[model samples]
Target: MDRPGLADFLRRRRELLRPTDVGVAEGPRRRTPGLRREEVAMLAGVSTDHYTRLEQSRGSAPSESVVAALARALRCTVDERDHLFHLAGLSPPPRRAARHVSPGLLGVAGRLVDVPVAICSDISEVVWTNTLFSALMGDVGTRPGRASNITWRWFTEPGVRDRAPEEERDRLAAAHVSDLRATYSRRAGDSDVTELVDDLLQRSREFRVLWERHEVAVRRSDHKTFVHPEVGAVELRCEVLLTPEADIKLLAYFPLEGTDAARKLDVLRVIGTQTFATA
Candidate 1:
């Protein structure tokens, strides 16, 4: 690993960001021009000491996961992220495997405090969720492994459908299967996609039935009714916004017109687990 170059890059990137840029409030006047090292470490889900070592050109090369996390934490662009990988003596992740929430995009989503925003991989892995989204759909992060994967959870766990209206369940299931089928075709022999499909075929008879139908389409827009126990039935217009590389999608749930959905969301924002409601 080009430790010196990686250290320099990390330092430069970290110094370019301010707390507000990443949804942090400006508290207790800071002497530094940008974010503190601890702040970057916290945002990247790493220990402050580890990040400090990297900046000091100490410690071993970061793993791929750590590299990706650093990219997001620093809000690195595609080009910058690749340079980081190169400096670390590692290849940049393939688009699908690196389907992380762009820190820039996450910052943007963070500003939509009242909206339910989530980032999902092309393969339907729930990568990240805004707090409102967690309150609305339940927390994806808390679920373990494939348990947090939207498609896997849908096909394997009936309880995952508790929020969706019973009538809409079948349609949602089919859409998920068909979308995954498209990924399976595009990625043909890629082990990740292949493994998911093969396991699903074995796990769910319904999945096997849907696969047999041979439908192919990417689900872009859909209307969903989330039957939240507290808010009654809340209707939302789900819109998908793709990243520049098209490997990750930003999902924003807007309250439907002419319903009490807007008010319900406002309520959720306030009662946000410990705060308030926007669910």
Candidate 2:
């Protein structure tokens, strides 16, 4: 937990992402290049000071639509989008436990073995990931208890920072945790969720503050940019499909307009296969 309050959360998340992450180009002399709060406000259609309050914890809960807009401006992932709601104290409708994946979705993922792909739970747990995902993310997804989690390594481990353009990785991790806090607020007494909350809260500080904001979001979807160690610069269009009959979600990735991301993905395919074979 790196971000404790709105101020820290805003500052931290901004630090982690590069200007390119928010669709801004790397400026000539920007020591740090993520979108400023004012810039983000313009994109999100909110007043600059108002948006600043949301980040600084001066303003209270944001409307659902506003949260969604900000998430889009940030190019958040489904997990991140959901987090936006949680931070705003909104509840998305819940579904049953065992959701089904569409054949079309699986087919699409299967066809993109070159790029990392995964199906995640509403809570950001990685339920299933393709071989390339396992290859790119190392063995985390392959491990029994480590699957379906986004912030585990991103927040707690140091190595992950090298893989993304974010300078505030810890802050973003905290934001996710804060989002989870808002989510679990709805099911506060559930043992499993409670335990997870306790674990993360004990493990990180940023989580504690964002959680206090009591934010929550129900909808999902977004774009993501990652600086893969192997793939120098990569942008991905991330989409989340809600499965019928359950709460499960399928998250998939595809390359952005122009980049060498595809070439790096090929390297990941080879690396993942080689790693798994040796294992």
Candidate 3:
């Protein structure tokens, strides 16, 4: 690894960002020109000491996940992110099919405070979710490994299946399988998608049956119902906004006008914000 170059690059990127750029407030007077080391560490989801060692060029090489997190925290452009990977002696992810969420999409998610919003990859993995989504969906992204995948969870987890109405569950399951099949066709050789398919084929008779149908359909806007534990049943419109690259999508849920779901969503927003603040 180009340790010195990596350190210099990280330092330069960190220094180029202001608190407001990353949705942080300009608090007390700072001795530095940009974000503090601790602030960057917090944003990157790493320990302050760990980030400090990285800046000092004394730590071990970061994993790809760590590098990706740092890239997001630094608000690096696509080229800058690739440079970071290179400096760390790793091949950069493909620009056409990046797994990392874009900063602009994340910014949009941040602005959606009242609605349930999540950023999903092409393969339906929840990369990031807003507080309201967690409140509505029960922290689906916190699941381990492939369990965080929406397709995987829909078929394998009873809790996920239980959220849908009994009559709709079968149709929902079929739609999810068809969506995954479309992704599998698009990214045929991708190991992660392959492993997920293999595992689902083994674990779920329902999935296997649907896969045999060879259905291929892309996800568009749809209506969905959620049986929230606290607020009961709420129906919402699910809208998907594809990024410029079309690799990542922002999935936002909104209540229909003049519906009971709208009132429930307002209650959910208040509860979700409070829960997030305390947590």
Candidates in descending lDDT order: 1, 3, 2
TM-score between candidate 1 and the true structure: 0.81
lDDT of candidate 2 over 5-71, digit per residue (tens): 4355456666666664443446577765466777777645678988887766665567655665565
TM-score of 3: 0.83
- TM-score of every prediction relative to native: 0.81, 0.53, 0.83
Instruction: Sort every candidate by TM-score, greatest first.
Output: 3, 1, 2
lDDT of each: 0.83, 0.58, 0.82
Over the stretch 226-251, how does candidate 1's per-residue lDDT look in tens digits? 98767778999999987765567888
Model 3, stretches more than 4 Å misplaced? 26-32, 36-39, 142-144, 273-279
Cα-based lDDT at residue 66, candidate 1: 78
Best by lDDT: 1
